[model samples]
Target: MSGQQPGRAGNPQVFQPLAADDPTTVAGYRLAAKLGAGGMGKVYLSYTPGGRPVAIKVIRPEFGEDPEFRRRFAQEVQSAQRVQGLFTAPVIDADTDGAQPWLATAYVPGPSLADAVVAHGALPVEAVLLLIAGMAEALHVIHGAGIVHRDLKPSNVLLAADGPRVIDFGIAYAADATSLTGSGVTIGTPSFMAPEQAAGRKVTPATDIFALGQVAAYAATGTPAFGEGTSHGVLYRIVHEQPDLSGVPERLTELVTRCLAKDPEARPTIAEVIRLCQTANAETVLRRPEDWLPSSVAADITVRAAAPAPVQTPPPPAAAPAVAYSPTAPVAPATPPPGFGPPQQQPVQPPVQRPGTPVPPAQQPPRPYPAPPAHAHAYAPTPFPAHQHQQQHPQPYPGAPVPPKSGGKRGVFIALAAAVIFTVAGSATAYVLQKDDGQQKQGSGGSAQGAEQGKGNDTTAAGGAAAGSAKPNAKADPKPADFKAINLTAGYHLTLGDDDVRPQQGEDGGYELSYDTGGYLDAETSEGNLVLLDPGQEGSLAVCRAETRFAKNIYLTKLAKGRQICVSTGTGHMGLVTVQGFSPEGSPSEYMTLDVTVWRNAVGTGSGSRS
Candidate 1:
């Protein structure tokens, strides 16, 4: 977080200022404002003359002129540019060769995974699964490009509104980049680094996989595999000791252990990691888990600078058949290709010069049409048959398809349909091939085979603490004859019972519910029930009972012992379930921790269904 401060000396709001007033600007862009800064450098708010905001980071003076650092920086940028991913921050522009080297990309606003954890706590199992799968998918892409994100940890991950996004590629490299450190200098986090990394061995995709494992463990248990220790002690443990996974859920321990393995070759490949994560029943990780989403998939993220807040006009629904990029426009279109969306909304425009003003011809506008947004352009037409199009049209890529007047409409229809079909098929094929390639390199089946070869561990929580009692708030009325039947009206509806009551409300403004097993609800006494509640909030909430088969399969008595049963949403909100014990005579006793959960929600969705 320590870096050069740009503006005033003592104000928190006076961050580095960017050059936004002039078109031909500073930092290789029309600087707008300071975005954020870190230990290495300051990221500025800049834009193409066309008005696309790019997060531009200029190297500190200390490192910019260092020949070694510059060479490495150049190589790193090249490697980063080759990575294609939905969950990773992609390079939009950079100039490592400049006087003051800098790297720039699309600015994403969100809390880091580290911030999320520190602010909230451990995420629920489903959120952890999604995090793992998304990071794995990103790694698969980086690996495919012959690069590895050597520094893969929670601090470098952004939990954006859309999903998880891996950022900060300063330490990423090609598969064979020269080592950046001395023999004894460590390059990664001690708690999450692979054994090989700790041993100072060459890093690889497996190393990242191992780091991801530690990230997952931390996500589930609010702690890392190696726990707290001195750097040397942590390294030693990573190299020679076993991870203390007593607190980790049964379903996640195997994966985390494999990731912490001393032999890097033994770890699962990125694809294999995704497969296990996808196959694993995340429900067993937390009770009453939230729904999951693929955070790794690239989203059409549009971040605009707030000024008078210029309005963007979307492109026409259909464009006349033409080349994707026109000679007049070399900039990539903001919108994806046809079938993705209506024509893209172009980047914001600068003030127009008056008719009598002598504006430089170089600064002349390309096309009057505004471009579409990012997702709209992600699937943009790959350049068409360039030579053929040029030779046929001599004018614009569109008007060149000269029509025999009457047959014009039919010709355009056939061409447009072909373009849509081709784009769709190509995208699908690429996704499948990429997925397969990732699995092959990581040897995922080996771990699954190991899992199958090993005997399954008992996952039942010890002590029958299935019956729970209502703890009336200190402000509430005296204990009701039967809290369950008393309509304990406070501010919200409270549903409580062993019977499968349709999703109801709670005492708070949010939906509230509490249930117990009793003879009155013998029919509802099957293992567990799926309580799906749509609070008419942002999204619905779901709660699964402990008696359910999936819940029993992943919960461990050891993990639940003396601990409260809690589940979290992907958005990082957690709720605790009380654990009540029972005697042989059917008398319910005070609650003592022994409850288990299979699934929970992740962090950062809208408001909760239940408070």
Candidate 2:
């Protein structure tokens, strides 16, 4: 592939002009231009007080509106600040409490590995080796601080003149913290995900090792180890099939294979990965050459590094007087630079009036100008003039009476008659509805009283028919025996030892239940008390009770919302838990909300029916 391309003789294609809606300054740093935007937010180019370039990622406004996201974002920023590796972009500053959360990292002025690989073909074997070594070292330092670079794709690795720099830990969470995965969301790229991660299992430092293998393979072959297609298909292949490392260099095949092992434990550790690279380089310390990257990649990096500094526009003088404009005077429009001017518009002409007619009052300007079109391209130029003016027009006062139309009296009479008729009809309907509601409430009260009186003898109930009959009613409104809904955050424990099931922060008690980041419901000490029914088997509590085999934990991977779980609590109460839904991914308080129904003293009797 040809690497030679046009240099930055003028403005570089990488640096885009700031749009009108884009903020020119965030916190104290003056934003120079737009670097790029992603799902999380926009990244702007800025400078520190010392004139060092930095990239500021301003989070999207919607995310800032969520208090849970703000908390997690602050935690991630703190963890990122602790990353002090040579080959990683360190977070130098952040403001998580601001209206728009943002964090700044030392800018690495170079093309990303994905960009370089796309521009030029796969790198030489030696370059790939060096790349792997640097990344391995970066991960070593990151994992040491109890962090996992969860999303370690090629695009996150920037190739600098010195070496590769890992960046963008936006999704990275603490190793011991809860996994960010939730229903309908995947934390990492499918092609780079370890088997466990793709299967919704627990993620550890070894997960990053699997990603490192994928990155190395992609860098050597210009394609992912798992061929790309739909995300589901790719994830399936990552979990169930071997990687396609045919095009990868022969020297790196064995090491890449080990790294891409299906079992996380089978993959080499980060330190071992570094040692493997050294061994590949003839059993000596791997040192970077002057031209560690291929010639074309090196030239691209040089162009990016040598890009001229952006020109800073001085703020407008505070004391300048507003310029006045006369309607009768003709003025020349100022010329704007190419690709940076507003669309042309035809001038509006004044209406001619009779000689005896009085002049109309001057109009007021519109309250707010229309927002920029949603379809406008990111690179579309906005109007850039020293001053802008709006023609003002008079506005009618609020609540002013509108002129009557023809047959106004007839229309008013019809409206009044319709309103009176509707009012009478509504009152009559309310009276009838209230009467019916009172009757239904009386019937329900009788049923509740009967149930309370018979509670002592109702413990010995059985059969699937009774449970199935009550299942439909449970969806409408849970019965009196149902426990209050419980919300269990990841890494927290839930105990059914008491009459009320409540979530505990830690697994300090010998409880029958706890949730894990892997989407599993586990019974820490009370094994064999929890049973997960098949999809269609959920309606029958008898089947749950008769189940001879029980697992210590049940995986919720791919489990439908509102699915039910059966558990015999430590207090000899049989309960049915209906999972409502999981909290949004990346939420600081990621939790699973469950509605539970309990049958007191019904565990060993096989007598607990939903009814």
Candidate 3:
């Protein structure tokens, strides 16, 4: 909100200092202050190594592990790099493989066309003509690269001192890939949608042109070509009705009309639109010496440009942690609230400590796993209660089956039968023998009696039998990772797919694994990265790669069978984890029983597609 006057400095409401939690530097560039924040990540004003200002966007941490999101993000970023147009914000640098990926673009210091429309009702006929030509030129470059902007609207167009700059083209699908969207489903902003896009039909370069028509009409009429309403109603109008371009200027109406045609074939190409604009206003130039923006908007931009950049100092160099990880570190259950600790099929059973093994720290950073229902091992006709004070457990995991009691009863019967046979044989000997033989028979009979009597108080043998019967409980020893299968919910999944993370047993009967993101992930950023923690350094994503490569890759050491992988997400929480058996009828995530011990203040963000 700063403004400057002749012979005076600008006011001080232009920019503010960084927040307490904001990172000082990102991907080697020192940050000054925030530009904006969105669901994806925060945008900050940073400078390249050479000191020219840039707008850097840091993706939210949870997106790092989403396979689908990562695929889309990588494809879009690569496409963005190929675009070099006069009316577009050019991408300068990016780290698509980092834990929390980020990209930097040449900063365009201006308000969006949406803001301009809100402030000043409708632009003059000359301004509307200029807007069309500039956007067409931008689309020409974008379509030339075999990419579709998908969502093109007034909010995505910025009006700078020079001209309008089209921004945010990173959501389009890969030009060469097939669609992952469900049949008859559409993807885009509603009000500005093209008819074909709204109907879930195939889109082409002309799809953007249709949106271009709406943008131009809005700039001229100060409202949408399609009447405003709910998303469904708006979409219905786009597909079934003609555009109401009643308020667009007469001189530009014909061109806008052609762009808004229901059929893609009826739309004019970007090149043709530019030629018509040139014919309408031969003097139009992107770099017009005269101020082109509305008076109030131009004054605001002038004041903002005159303000000084926020002061920033370089962060201190940081030393790296240990170069190696201890595979022998004690294993534990993977906790779900903040981690996938150990599986909780039954009540949490304490792990018996073994001597001489170095135990990992008791606490670790939290993961995005959810805790299994309290009656995790039990099966019933009704759904398990999650918020109740007590839980009923009637069964254990099949992996730890309870042995039959009939076997113990059979052993006792066999022992008693042997004692009776010995007594009968001694009595027969007594009848057949004389005095000396009778004495031997008596001794034998006494021994038989002693053996039968011993059964009454055979506490030692009974104790052994009781221990044998408890073998079912003994099956509970394997840690979370020791389970055979794991599934995830729709909202939660690892970048490494099910096949990639399944521990493979080699010919040598040991887990054989390569430390990589199977076929889908980037080795540069994931080599040692743990999903439950922040990328150690923004300057370099490889800081924690060494520690997490094996974990991320699902390499199980003999020691890892019960290994406790402690995770630390930048969010304040610790995750204790163990994995076990899965339910038969639910999703992988739902049945993937994890023993999770969330620390005192675990966050609740992992249950959905985090941001």
* TM-scores vs. true structure, each candidate: 0.43, 0.49, 0.46
Candidate 3 residue 183 Cα shift, in angstroms, is 17
- The total of clashing pairs for model 3 equals 42
Off-target runs (Cα >4 Å) in candidate 3 are 1-17, 172-187, 282-289, 306-311, 314-611
Best by TM-score: 2
lDDT of 2 by residue, 537-572 (tens): 453445555664567778777344446787766665
Q: lDDT values of the candidates?
A: 0.47, 0.63, 0.52
Q: Which stretches of candidate 1 lie above 4 Å from their native place?
A: 1-26, 30-35, 170-187, 282-611
Global lDDT of model 1: 0.47
Stretches off by above 4 angstroms in model 2 are 1-12, 170-187, 307-611
Find the 10 residues in a row with the least total lDDT in model 2: 1-10
Please give the TM-score that candidate 3 achieves against the real structure. 0.46
lDDT of 3 by residue, 66-146 (tens): 667777778778878889998888888888788777888876666667766676677887777777888888888888766
Q: Higher lDDT: candidate 2 or 3?
A: 2
> How do the residues 91-154 of candidate 1 rate in per-residue lDDT, one tens digit apiece?
8777777777677776554445665566567787777777887777777777776666777777
Error of 1 at 136 (Å): 0.6
